[model samples]
Target: MKHSRILSRATAALALAGAAGTAAAHPGHAASLADGLTHPFLGLDHLLAMVAVGLWSARALPAQQRWQGPAVFVAALLAAALASLGGVSLPGVELSIAASVVLCGALVAGAREIPARAGLALVGATALFHGLAHGAEAPMGGFGGFAAFALGFTASTAALHLAGLWLAARLQRLPALAWSFIGAAVGTGGLALLAARL
Candidate 1:
């Protein structure tokens, strides 16, 4: 019933969810719809960044502008993911992914007012890295495998964003305060991932 309790519970839930992520996604296991659905949960970085985007959207953008950022993000993500099929791979994807998580946290924690266009651009830019990472490593099992994998991760990403939005709206205090804590946790997760690779 207390706001602090609610926030703590929410934060713990997110941390537990992050702990459940794996290092890599293998699309060979994603031929089924269920397999694809679980693909985005494969990495903590993906989980944090995706949800952070939604949290940022709810906090920074107005009601009319909220959908734009997320829409652009999804489009940019698809482009980068599809590009990986052509063998256009990015170096330092892990680091880039980690950085994106950090950036997402900063943006959510700050939650400054910004133009919708600028916000959309920011969301789109970071999403490109996340998408490319998944696309490059996606298993080449033909259209069905690729489709399932793509669909799974995409849906999962959307769900995470919604969760972030829900949390942003539900917190009793300033959204930024609750989000700042979440951001800190997500940033910490990114640091751990970066350290693991280095």
Candidate 2:
């Protein structure tokens, strides 16, 4: 019960912050850099996979391993950017993004603790697909606007990971059913993304 309350409060706080961020990003325009930044957050597959990175990171190692998670993700983002600049033709990028959710969720559900290097490699590879999709999809515009949007999106990703960490911490005390539910939801989101791709 206590854990549930904490989760609820944390979720509420994130929602409020996300709303504020959205408003700041776009005041009148139906679409803007903020929207671009938020595109991933609006999708369950993206949200779950990003959060799962943090959750799995937490479960895999001690607090000292914190940097590993974000570092790997950033590296993946860089790879994706490079791929976009090179005009790499990656087929089924969306499917890969969705599959990331299922893969990461299953890792967490199984409580698998991979080696640090191996884990980072896995995350980096997955991030490539995500980053490429975003890069390819971004509207051509001013570099300044693009930079801002990217920063906002990155910040949002971090926020989501924080939320996931908080939830994971609380869920740790609960029965396995709660964690399994999270995995199921993430996997379902992956399937939805896959179907959309079809």
Candidate 3:
């Protein structure tokens, strides 16, 4: 429990540092940089999905398996970056991202005890979609600014994952139905985003 708390605090601090870096990188467009940095956090569909990654990781494995979760996440980020650089055209990326939130949340709520390798596979696949979206949407002209934004966003993601870990630890005590409701909420938000796009 103490370890979890420490991790959570560290994640939050990293998030703040990433945001600061982004701000520093774009001095003339502080507002823009802030907005860019926050773009990933604003939408419920996005935030929930990212958090769900962590939650799913925690619930799907023992404490010893924790490292795989972050590793898969980083791998996904790298894959997405590569895809973006390669100019892959993913038409429904935003909607797919929204759906990932729902899917990952459901996986967590179900408390599925997947093998570490399977969990990594699932996360890596999802990361590709997310990474592509992030890469495609990145600003073209300001590499420094974009780098800062990416750093902040990545930090925020890690923090949310930590939060998810904390939440999952607590939720383990709750009824399964209650957990299902959490999944339903996440799914509902994703569906709403999908609806909006359509």
Best by lDDT: 1
Instruction: Indicate the worst ten consecutive residues by lDDT in candidate 1.
Output: 21-30
Using Cα atoms with residue i matched to residue i, what is each candidate's TM-score against the true structure?
0.84, 0.75, 0.74
Q: Write the per-residue lDDT of candidate 2 for residues 1-198, one digit (tens) a residue.
A: 887675456444433332222111112222356765676566665676788787767666577776577668866775675566457758877678767866776666555445766777777787887777666654455455556656666777777777667667666675555555555555655665566556
Cα misplacement distance, residue 41 of candidate 1 (Å): 1.4
Local accuracy by lDDT, each model? 0.73, 0.63, 0.62
* Ranking of all predicted structures according to TM-score, beginning with the best and ending with the worst: 1, 2, 3
The Cα error of candidate 3 at residue 150, in Å, is 1.8
Q: Tell me the lDDT of model 3 at 137.
A: 64
Give each model's clash number: 1, 0, 0
Candidate order, lDDT descending:
1, 2, 3
- Which model, 2 or 3, shows the larger TM-score? 2
- Model 2, position 85: C-alpha lDDT score: 42
Over 101-153, each residue of candidate 3 has an lDDT whose tens digit, in order, gives: 65765676665645667767777777777677666666666566567656766
